[model samples]
Target chain A: MCGIAALQLKDPALRPQLGSMMHAMLCEIVDRGPDSAGIAVYDVERFVHAGQSTVTLLDSPSSDEELSAALAAELPSAGAVEVRTLGDTTLVSAAVDTAILTAALRAVAPGARQIGRGTHVANLKGVGNPVDLAETFGLASVSGTQGVSHTRMATESAVTASGSHPFTVDDDLCLVHNGSFSNHATIRRGLRAQGIEFDSENDSEVAARYLAMRLREGDDLTTGLENLRETFDGFYTLVVTTADGLAVLRDPIACKPAIIAETDQWVAVASEYRALVDLPGIETANIFEPEPGEVYTWEF
Target chain B: MGVLNEEVVDLHVSTVRELNSALHKAHDGEHWRVTNPGGAHNVAVGIDSEIDVVIDGHVGYFAAGMHQKGTVTIEGSAGTGLAENMMSGRVHVKGNASQSAGATAHGGLLVIDGTTGARCGISMKGVDIVVGGNVGHMSAFMAQAGRLVICGDAGDSLGDSIYETRIYLKGQARSLGSDCIEKPMREEHLAELAELLAAAGRTESPSEFRRYGSARTLYHFHSENSSAY
Candidate 1:
C-alpha cells in the first residue's frame, strides 16, 4: 500500500517550516510505502492562466544559471513558466499554447514534456526513495504551507520515480490515493473520449484527472471530491491538495484506513496515526479516523 | 493474608502479545481481577485451557475472537465483531456487542446480555449463540450449521438463506429467509434449551423458547428457489 501525508499549516511562517515536517511525516510511514517519495507545494499566484494553457516538464535537470537563461529566452513567446527548484530538480511551471511549449521543450530536450506541468496542474512525484528524491531535488529543506507527499509501494504501476504519487491534473489539483480504483478502465476510456491526456497508465492519475476536470468546470474542491467519491467505485482514501486548501475523502465502504489529527496550529492527515507519532503535543491532539463517505477540507 | 482486602492485577498494557502473555500467567485456577482494559483487540484469542478471564472494561474488535476451551467475560460494550470466527469455548459479555458477533463461528458458545448489532451470527458454521436482548437485522444470514437462541425480538430478514443452523427465539422475527421456518418445540429441544439457558446464567424457564431451523426443501438449489440468491 502507498502512504500519503498532507499538512495544511495555519501559520504562514510555518509554511516554509513544512519541508522538514513533511519529511518527518513521510519518514515515519516508510514501512507502509518505501519505493519513491515526492512532495508538491502550490504557489497559486505563480501558476494560473487566463485563457488556453499548456503544461509540460523540462527534460534535463537544469542548473540555476541554465534555468534563468531558458526562462529569459522562452518568456518572449511563452506566457509565463514559474521556476522553482527543490534541489537539482527545477520545476518550470508554465501555461502557454500546448503546441508552442510542446515544440519548445522537445526542441531543447527529446523528453522535456515528460517533466512538464500544465493547466489544472499537480507536480509531486519522483523515481526513487524519498531521501533520494529529496537529495536529487533538494526537498529536505524546502517548505510550503499546503502540499501533498506520497511514498509509493508500486503495486499497480511499475516502480519508477514517475510512478510515485501525488499525481496532478492540468496543474491545479493534486490527488494521492491509498486503494485501487475498481472502475478505472471504464473511467479511463470515458476520459479519453473527452480529450484528457495521460502520461503513465496508473489509476491514480485517472482519478486525479477526473477530479481536476470536475474542478475545472467550476466545482469547488469539496464538491468535486464528493462527486469523485460518488462516481468512483472502490476502496480509496484520497487527499487532494489545491491552491486554496486541502480536501480529504474516503470511499463509502472504507476498506482503507485514513487517520486525521488536528491542532489549533495545523491539520495533519495520514494513512495511520503512526505517521503523526513524532509531532509534538500529539498526546493531547484531537485525532480520529476519517469516516467513510465524508469529505474533510482544511484551508491553508 | 496481607493487609489489603483484595489484590487487583492492573492489566493496563499495550500490544496484543503483552496482554495475552499476562493472561496466561494470571489465570491458573485462581480468580483473576482486571480493570481498565481500554479497547484491546483479540484479548482472549487462542486461549484453549479452562480458566475464567474477566475483563473490567470495553474491548476492541474481535475481543474473544477464536476462543476455545475457556470462559472469557467482558464488563462493557464491545467494538465491531466481538467473538468473531470463534471455535469451541464460551464468551460471556455483560454489555452490548457490535456488528457481526459470532460471525462464522464454529463449535463455541457466545452469550450476550444486551442488544447485538446487524448481521449477528452471520455465516455461523457450528457455534451456539444466545442473545438476551434484541438482535439486529440480517442475523443468522447465510448461516450453515449452528444454533442461535434469541430471547428478544429479531430484526428484518432473520435467517436469510440459512443452512442447517437451528434458531430459537422468545420474541418475534421480522421475516424468515427461504428454507428457514418456525417449527414445533419437542422434548429434546426443551432439554437443549435448558442446558443453553443454564450456560448463559439465566433463571428463566426453557418452555418460553420457540424453535426455528431449515425446512430442508432448499438443501439443493432449485429454479423455483433461485430468487433467494
Candidate 2:
C-alpha cells in the first residue's frame, strides 16, 4: 500500500504555511508507505515565476553554475537560467516556454533524470522515510499555493528516485497514485505506439504518461482522468494537481482509500483521515469520501 | 457524560496501548471518555470487558475491533474496518464511515448514523449492522451470518454469494450480486426487523423495508450449473 496527502490552499494567507501543513499531513500517513517518497510544491515565486518555466531533476551530474551556464548557452533566447539544489534534486527556472527550457536542459545534462517540469511545480523525492526526505528538502519551510505528496510501497517497480511518485511528466501536472493498474502493460504498449516515452517500469508512470498524452490531445484534467477510467482497469485512488487546480478520482470498485475535505480556506485529500485531522479548520471542514467512479475537481 | 464514575483518557497524553490495556483490565461498571482520538488506528481494540467508551473525535482503522463486551461510541466518522471480528459489543458512529465498516464480525451491533464507503459489511458473521444512511458497494458480500438493516439506499452488489444472512433495505440498490435476490417478507421477518430497528433507535416501519437473502442457487455446486460459480 501507498499513502497520499495533497492540500490546495484557497486563501492567500494560507499559502505561506503550505509546506508545514503538508508535512504534518504526510507525517501522519507515513506508516502506510515507508519504502520511498516524493513531494510536489506549486509556488509561483519560489519554483516558477511570471513568464517563466521551471524544471526539477533528480541528481544532476553538473553543479548549479555549470548546469545554468550550459542551459543558457544551449538556448541564448532562454535568458537568465537559475539553478538551485534542494535535497537530491535541482530546480532550474528560466524565462522561456517549458518545452524550450526542458529541451535545453536535456541537451546540457543528458544523464539527469527529470522529475517535474512546469510553470509552477517543484519536485523532490528519495528512497528513505518520507519525513526524513521532507526534512532534507526543507519541506517545512518551503512556501507554496498547493502541494501533493506520496509515499510508495513499491509494488510494480523498484525502489528508486525515478519510481517515487508525484510523477510530473507534463508541465504543471503532477499525479500521485495509491494503487496499481492491472491492464497498464496493454495500455503502455498503446501509449508507446503513440510516441509517449516512459522513464521507469512502474505502473503509475504509465498512468502519468497516459494523462499527459490526453491533456496534450486537448482533454481537460477531469476528462483525461475519465478517459483513463474507461481505458485502464484496476484499483486506483489518484490526486492530480495542474496549473490551476486539483482533482481526485478512484476506481469503480474503490478498493483504495481516499477522503476529501473542503472548506473556504483549503481543499485537501488524503488516503486516510489521519492526514487531514491536523489542518487548521478540519474540525469544521465538510469532509466526505468521493463516490466511486466519480471525479472531484477544485479550481483555484 | 457519566460524571459519577467516569474516567477520562486523553489519547494525546496516553499511548493507545496504555488505553487498550486499561480497557481490557477495567471493571464491568467503569465508564471511559476518550478525547482527542485524532483518527488514530486501532484505538480501544480487543476489549474483553463490560466497559463503556466514548471517543470524542474521528478514529482510524479497526477501532473497537475484536470487541467482546463493551459499548464503544465514536462522536465523529470512522476509518476502515470500524469493528471487524467483534465477539460482542455495541459500536455507534455519529458521522460517515470509510470502507469495510464491519467485516467478519462474529457478534455485535454496529450503527452508522451517516453514509458509509464501499464494502460496509463484507463477510460478516453473526453481527447486526444498522445504517441510518446509505451503505456503499458490496455492502454484505459473502456475508455468512448477520442481520443488515439499511435505513437509506445501498450501493452496488447488495449481497454477493451470501449465506444465511438476512438483509433489510429501505431504499434502492444499484445492483444485486449473484445468488442474492429479494425474498418475500413474512410475519417473523417483520417482527425481527422491528426489534432490530428498535435496538438501533430507528423509527422506520418494518413494512417500509424490503427483505433480501441468498437464493441458494449456488450453495451446492453441480456439473450442469458449474458456470455460475
- Candidate with top TM-score is 2
Q: Put down candidate 1 lDDT per residue, A1-300, tens digits, no spaces.
A: 877888888867675666677777877666678887767655423333445343435335566457546754765655455655543244554546555655565555455444335543336456666766655554546655666778888788888656767776555567788999889889999999999888778888889889989988989888888898888888798998776778888876565667677888788888755567566555556765565587999875
- Tell me how many clashing residue pairs each candidate has: 20, 1
Q: What DockQ does each listed candidate score?
A: 0.08, 0.90
Clashing pairs for model 2 are B126-B145
lDDT of 1 by residue, B15-54 (tens): 5677676666654454444566654556667776676777
- Superposed by TM-score, candidate 2 places the C-alpha of residue A64 at a distance from the truth, in angstroms, of 0.9
Q: Per-residue lDDT of A1-300 in model 2, one digit per residue for the tens?
A: 999999999999988899889999999989999999999989746667778888989879988998888888898887789999876789999999999888887888988999999888888889999999999888887778998999999888898888999999999899999998999999999988988888888899899999999999999988999999999899999999998889999999898999999999999999999999989989899999998999999998
The alpha-carbon lDDT assigned to residue A264 of candidate 2 equals 96
Let me know the DockQ for model 1: 0.08
Q: Chain B alone, TM-score of each model?
A: 0.87, 0.97
What TM-score do all the candidates reach, one by one? 0.62, 0.97
Looking at model 1, residue A35 earns an lDDT score of 83
